[model samples]
Target: MEVKVTSSTILPSPTSHHSDIPLTIFDRFAANIHIYVIYAFTPPTPSNADLISALSKTLVYFPTLTANLSTDCHGRPCVSVGGPHEDRGALVVEATVLSKLEDHLPLTPSPDLRLLHPDAENPKHLLQVQLNRFQCGGLVIGLTSHHRVADGRSMCAFTIAWGKILRGVPIDPLPFYDQPWLKPRNPPLVQFDHWGSEFIHLSPQSNEFIITRTDVDPSEITNLLLHFSPDFITKLKAQTNKLSTDKHTTFETLLGYLWRKMTIARQLDDEECTTLSVSVNGRRRLQPTVPPEFFGNLVLNAYPKAKAKALIEGGAATAAGIVREGLRFIGEDYFQSFIDFGEVYGDRDLVPCFEKDGNVLSPKIEVDGWLGLGFDEVNFGGGGKLCAFLPTWVPFEGLLIFSPSLSQSGGVDVFVSLLEKHAVTMREISHSLD
Candidate 1:
């Protein structure tokens, strides 16, 4: 359904949930991160004032939505989560608002991407919405969520449930929040292999600088995820073997191509190092395998590398082959080794391969039925027409996302964002499609 792009409304602060202690998984997740976003729309016919009130009641139905912060096992700061029943966690909603829909900002990159500051006196996050008031007075919504509590896929599920409650329909597929995958290993697998060092905090003496800066023309930094056809994917799986052949499917092949492209985009000297990494879910791979539904931070980082000079001189297919090899090395044994590192290091810092001056690229392939699971089904009082899964931060120097192309072509939506200097080079490489 086409959603009008402009309209306005005023949403007041939600009445606090009636609880004192931490309660459910939602409370725990929301407590750790101090950010979230809301994008919603009203019906074209405009629901009666009573209907709006009825729709808003869903907020209070799930008490876990509102939680309070407490401590954890160690003296370190942590969230005291509430039980599934209600009332037992930390709930700190930083930003919430309702307004008319208007012009949409492009999906490209931006220099002024929102920033999060723990020291900000007031909440640092921003909740913005542009409403399109239709002649019939209906509405369409768009939203962006911070990457702290949930990913785009999880947020989509939440939005759908909210809509179901607003429309007074049965909560179909009820919210599934099984996050057992991120738990510590049963016997505590421990090792230090390829992931021996990853994501290190800067030391005062280190010559490297750690800074995150956005570039100009927010739209210029488009996040793109190149997807291979199903036939291609099937063939790739057959041709590439993680155990021996230095070949990997879409993720590895694409990343290899991107690493070369990004290096060119950034114009790094031939001698400089280049890094490519992606997030691996540690759930099913964890020792004894956690429940599929379990959902906390069940992710591990993997980087397959190649030198700048090596990639640029090598053609795309050749470079891609190198990437495939790197990824093939990351089979089950590699994952198990990674778990060992986590068990040994726990939350301690590990030095990452991407040095301060290093040029890096990260590309991700979207799994099926991800954000689309319940996007259209979401409704508040007015109900929503159009909605988007927005990610506030790229985290790395450049991020490429591959999502199901929302349009009928079934092509995957590709989102790309990177530093301005690299934008030009990436644009050229993007045009060199296979």
Candidate 2:
């Protein structure tokens, strides 16, 4: 589908800048990557002007987004809300498609999806949005944001807040950035060793683990989306828990099943080790629970690994058990330890361990989930469910993302990025309970 650019404008935030905000320890580890999120609505969608008005109002609540990604005096990443003489704005692009959105139902991730959003690598603003209008009066909103500024949960809350503002609803328990709890203890208690798992030192004298990129043909990489029905999940849980009486959550069961299948599809050697980087949320697990509306990255990645032979032979049930335990390990103490590490280790040369992983993470898998996020309740566009929503094209392989199904209430939509051959093999065995 061809997209014609209509008009482009910068929408400035309406708020008084108090001061620049520093990135918390939780925010330091996020990669410097931007993602394009596409949300399409059918005909009778709101006018572009109306959407902009709502967005402007929403920005009043999240003024930090209008600012730029800047480094503080100590060269640490932080949100530059503004100084005495500085003011910034977000980028908004208006586009038009000559085809009806219904004709392109169930939109999948592809290079063309990038056309619906602003350039993915924009550095001027933390938040950028595009409004794509279809010939049939349908509308698709494309948004791109810097990953270092916020996490999935934060973005979801911002979206919901924008929706509420658009519908004339009060944003009860409004979003907040004042997190006094993140202050470091007087006597910083560094309980856990985070040298290798999360952060790696970047000092010249220290031997840092080097990351190498896999140079594979771009054409060989593909993104495959799969919809797992509710009934299939019920059977997967039953089959996975046959040996033990304990029931597992849908996430755990699916994580295990997907890991096993992906390993088999990759056809790894029996002795080769495979690792799954599970994203763990510390909001509720922290000592003083982080508020749901608190806007920032409050998460970490947990690693679960085993020899290929053991993982395959252990079956999804055993795999699920590994995943369960991996998540169980990241509790209040773990969060406090990471905070303590950041408190005492601040200003030291630091970088995320996973940042060096190359294009093809064959024996390694990275996962991010967006299930049960209440995104379905957003009614700003057409006063109904979004026609389509998913990640744009990603270059990495062995990456997994779980999203709530747009059409199925209790179902899941799995997004897999892998080598074309491996993707083909994974799809062939996607539905098997074994």
Best by TM-score: 2
Candidate 1 C-alpha error for residue 180, in Å: 5.7
lDDT per residue, candidate 2, 8-31, as tens digits? 888775655545677888888887
RMSD per candidate (Å) reads: 7.8, 1.8
- Provide the global lDDT of candidate 1 against the true structure: 0.43
What is candidate 1's lDDT per residue for 1-434, written digit by digit as tens? 23322233333224432323312222222223333222334345334343335434543433223333444455322333333323222212122123233333222222222321122223322222232233334343334333333444445555565565656677555544454333445676644444323434445654443534333454434443444455544454444343334445455555555566677777777777665555554444556664433323344445556667877786555666766554455555555655555555544434444442223333222122232334444456443444333343343446655444333234334455665566666766764644
Candidate 1 has what TM-score? Answer: 0.60
Alpha carbon deviation, residue 384, candidate 1 (Å) = 7.3
What's the residue-level lDDT of 397 in candidate 1? 46
Q: Output the worst ten-in-a-row residue range by lDDT, candidate 2.
A: 79-88
Residue 409 of candidate 2: its Cα lDDT?
60
TM-score of 2: 0.96
